[model samples]
Target: MDSIDEVLGELPLPPYVTAEDVGFAVKALAVHAAEQWPDGPRCRNDRAPHPCRLHRWGQRVLDQRGLTDRQVQVLIAEQQAPQR
Candidate 1:
């Protein structure tokens, strides 16, 4: 873990995972997707370590909602698609 991560700590999770929460989670995961860096992979959004706080929170929410890895990928892809 990075020094900043240690200082900032992990983001809190929602008490109840709802459909809206799932949507937000999907968005979070997609927006916070990892980026390659000279040091290593980091968060594209916040530029924190890979699987940043928001990213981990999103994955946790989706896991709580019973979404599999494949399902999560699909959700991310759908979000990435251009709106017609």
Candidate 2:
């Protein structure tokens, strides 16, 4: 699948992203992160070609939130880290 919502149709973005949206966006980033594949990389969660829809959505959200590359890396690492 390309995204969890694949064929479900796109949802509209909020006029402005709220804290709740950020939380969801972060989760999407974590869950939909890219993965390596024999046929080339794909989304770990969605199994779409790497950097799939949700991934792009997450990136766009992070960018809109003014996160830098380094900050984004930190965010991704934090998301991937095992919980205590």
Candidate 3:
């Protein structure tokens, strides 16, 4: 079956990665986290295949920012932490 991206196309990335873009990216990854199904992994939020479009877009944004895996983890952790 054609993936959502194949039908609707990918969401556009910002021309320039900014702080706000990074924040949004972090949220996207957090919200679009994967879940296991009998067949395979899928997006927790949308039930689409794992690594859904928004998840990929967020990864690309982080890649464009040259963030290390550790940094990305920290960002995700911080994103999930309770706010004061």
Which one wins on lDDT? 1
Q: If both were scored by TM-score, which would come out higher, candidate 1 or candidate 2?
A: 1
Model 3 gets an lDDT of 0.91
Per-candidate clashes come to 0, 0, 0
Instruction: Pick the winner on lDDT between candidates 1 and 3.
Output: 1
Instruction: List lDDT for all candidates, in order.
Output: 0.91, 0.75, 0.91
Native-vs-model 2 lDDT? 0.75
Q: lDDT tens digits, residues 1-84, model 3?
A: 226579888878899999999999999999999999998998999988888999999999999999998999999999899999
Candidates sorted by TM-score, descending order?
Answer: 3, 1, 2
lDDT (10s digit) by residue, model 1, range 22-52: 9999999999999999999999998888988
**How many Å off is the CA of 55 in candidate 3?**
0.4
lDDT of 1 at 22: 99
TM-score of 2: 0.72
lDDT of 2 by residue, 1-84 (tens): 444557764545667877777777788878877788889888888688877777777778777877787887786688778999
TM-score to native of every candidate shown? 0.90, 0.72, 0.92
List the RMSD of every prediction in angstroms.
1.2, 3.1, 1.3
